[model samples]
Target chain A: MSLDLFLNQVVPVRQKLFRFAYRLLGNEEDAQDITQDALMKVWSQQEKMPELQNMEAWCMRITRNLALDKIKSRKYRLADELDRAGEVPAAQHNPHAMAEKNDVMGKVRQMIHELPEKYRTLIQLRDMDGYSYQEIADILELDMNDVKVNLHRARKAVREKLQNIQVYGL
Target chain B: MDYNQIIAILDRYWEGETSLEEEALLRRFFSEPHPDMPEPLQEAVPLFGYFQEEIANEAALPDMPEIPVVATSSARVVRLSPFRHWMKYAAVLLMAIGMGYAMKQYQQREVKASLAEIQQQKLEAETRMAYLETKKALELLAKNLNKGTTQMQKLSYFNDATGIITGTN
Candidate 1:
């Protein structure tokens, strides 16, 4: 693909890529940096762009790999806790219902964070990013059946955990 | 989006049978509240609501820096190859030390050349002194020889006087 084609076609989906990266990394700065870096990679590799089948999926895969690399490179990352997550203000809603909603969302975030990498990634792609099974498989380099099975198991696990949080208020 | 239909979709959703569109429908159904919405389904509102809000908050993409494309230039690379960053410093150091060593060696040679000139002058002075002393000694010997010849001439004069007395007189 030409550089102009890459700039117009691949770079425009940066918002979706950033959202996916933010969901995986749980921090805005890392997400933004990874998204930009992924787009820059596409620009750098424009000569090989025509060989790619799906440009959006390719960019997402690059974002995923870069985010995972960032996660790996952090030497002292805490488990289930992002360094900057506490600073982000909760969503503005009715002050009374906002507290309860924020609490539930916090619980859900924790449950998602606790999942194994494969399952959590599948859930993020399917439920949040709304990628089809084939697209998820393409991005993740997994079999289509494996994607479905993992997504089902992941959804079941999260639902069970959310139900526990409601019943026991834990 | 009635309560029973939502419930059935939720069942199908848990069974992993929902298409992307069907899942979107379910997410939309739970994201807002219905008066007839059961409380059991109310618990699921946060999960789907979080996903909707998560994606809906359209974060503006951060500005990307432009990368300039440069054509291949061979001369630029060849000119820059010998002076790597660290090696440049090392080359300067070596040049400085080499200049210092050369300076010291030149200074030593200068000293040696001056010393040789001084020794040659001293030798010439000594030879001049010896030649002057020998000239003085030879002049003294010549004067002594002239004095001895004069004394012999006086002795020969006395013999000539005796010969003249014994002649025609």
Candidate 2:
């Protein structure tokens, strides 16, 4: 497709991509850099883009690779260091909030963070990105059935973890 | 609590047997405020709720940067071809060296021509100096010859004077 049409249609999805990266990396700066780098790469390779079957998925795949590389390189640890140094503001804890609102949500996020990278990624693609199983499979390079199976297990694990947290209060 | 129905679908879910519609049904059932839900299922609601929140919030994510569309009319995978990369550097180096060698040869030829012209000029100057010296010597000789002729005329006048004096005697 032409660059204009690609940008017009695909550029609007940058925020969603950023959100996905932020959710995965749990750091805004890293997410922003990854998004920028991924977009730049996509921009650079605009000449060899695949057919427009799923531009967003293609972009997500690129973002995922970049984020994974960043994670592998441990470059994100710099952001983590900054976060620890109080340079970065902590997420709101809201100590006086309702149990359902704060504790449950907090536990859910913790459970998601605790999930294996593969499961977290699958869940992110499916739940957060709203990709279909086939699309998730395409992005993750897994079988269609494998995508469904992993997603189910990932959700189930999160559910179990949350249930334990609520019941045991630990 | 109808745990059996929920359990049945949950089993299907784990096996990847549930369709999107069935999954949506599970999400709907779990998200609703049902007082009859089992303790385990009730505890699971918030997790499902979080998933729902994440999905709904997906639309609310910050704006993503625009990705430029590459025209894929000739959609070939672009790898940096090793040969092409090498050839590009090779061509640049070749051009640089070729220009350098050409410049060196040109300077050498220029220096040689300058030396040859300077030698020719020196030879011409020497020839001109020799010719001038020869001409100066000839002029000097001519001046000496003219003085000799005047001396001979004086001598003849002296003889005429002596002859006149003697005849007058």
Candidate 3:
């Protein structure tokens, strides 16, 4: 395919790619930086990329690699400081109608953040980005069965955490 | 309440048995407001809601910076000729072998030159030692001949004196 056509197709998926990076890295600046870096890589190899079957998945794979590199380089602590800081105010408020939604959302984010990096990454791609199992497997370089298994386990873990929260009144 | 069916599906899900359609069905089922649902499945409602919300949020991510365009050439798509690839590899291999052979030849020449130099020095030292020994032997022979000549002259003087005394008597 021509360069213009490739860019036209890939540029629109940039946002979703950035979002995946953001979730993986947990920082907006790093996400943006990784997204740009991935785009540059794809641009450099545009000649070899058009032959690829799933361009979006390929681009996302690049983005995921870049984000993981950033995480490994800077050693981001997985304490979910962003979620915790945002949660403090909601935690202080009572279970008011509007606050309850925020609390639930906060708890969900915390649960996701608490998941292992492997499971969290697959979950972000499969559930958040809406990628198919095959696409997730390709992007993550895992077996299709592994993707399905991890996605299931990740969702189940979240479900279990929510159940425990309700039972223990957290 | 059909909580047993939901539980069974959840168990199957963790085992990686659920299809994409089945997963979507679970997501939808959990999303509904079922007041009569079991306590565990009830708690799962908020979690599923969070998943959907997060997905929507990801889809709504802001635009990223535009990537710079690169020039594309159609000629690049043509597969490299097999013969050309083979030639390239052969050239690389030949160059590597040639370099190794050149290095070996250089080392051998260095060793040969050094050996020749050592042999030449040993020959020159042997010639100088032979010349010094010959000069010492010639000096010893000359000293011995001078001593013999002196002894013969003294004996002739003695003989002449004895003959004169016998004639007078």
Best by DockQ: 3
lDDT of 1 by residue, B1-169 (tens): 5688778788778778889998989877876767777876766776787676556553443444453546555565445555568777998999999999999999999999999999999999999999999999999999999999999999899989978988848
| Candidate 1 CAPRI category | acceptable
Provide the overall lDDT of each model, using Cα atoms, as 2-decimal numbers: 0.79, 0.74, 0.76
DockQ of every model listed? 0.28, 0.30, 0.36
Per-residue C-alpha lDDT of model 1 across residues A58-167, encoded as one tens digit per residue: 88889999988888888525335465355346666688777787777777767777889888888878887789999999899889998888888888887888788888
Q: For every candidate, how close is chain A to the native chain A in TM-score?
A: 0.83, 0.80, 0.84
TM-score (C-alpha, index-matched) for candidate 1: 0.63
Tell me how far the alpha carbon of residue B55 in candidate 3 is from the true structure, in angstroms, after superposition: 2.8
The candidates, ranked best first by DockQ, are 3, 2, 1
lDDT, residue B131, model 2: 100
State the lDDT at B120 in candidate 2: 100
lDDT of 3 at A71: 75
lDDT of 2 by residue, B1-169 (tens): 4677887876676555676666677787877778677764566577677787766654555565444445567668978867768878899999999999999999999999999999999999999999999999999999999999999999999999999999999
Q: Which predicted model would earn the best TM-score?
A: 1
Chain B alone vs. reference chain B, TM-score for every model: 0.45, 0.42, 0.39
**First chain of model 1: TM-score?**
0.83
lDDT (tens digit, per residue) of candidate 3 on A1-170: 55565667789888887888888876677789888898888888888775888888889889988888877888875436555464343344456765777777777777777889888887666555557888888888889888877787877787678777787856
Query: Which consecutive 10 residues in model 1 chain A have the weakest lDDT in total?
Result: A75-84
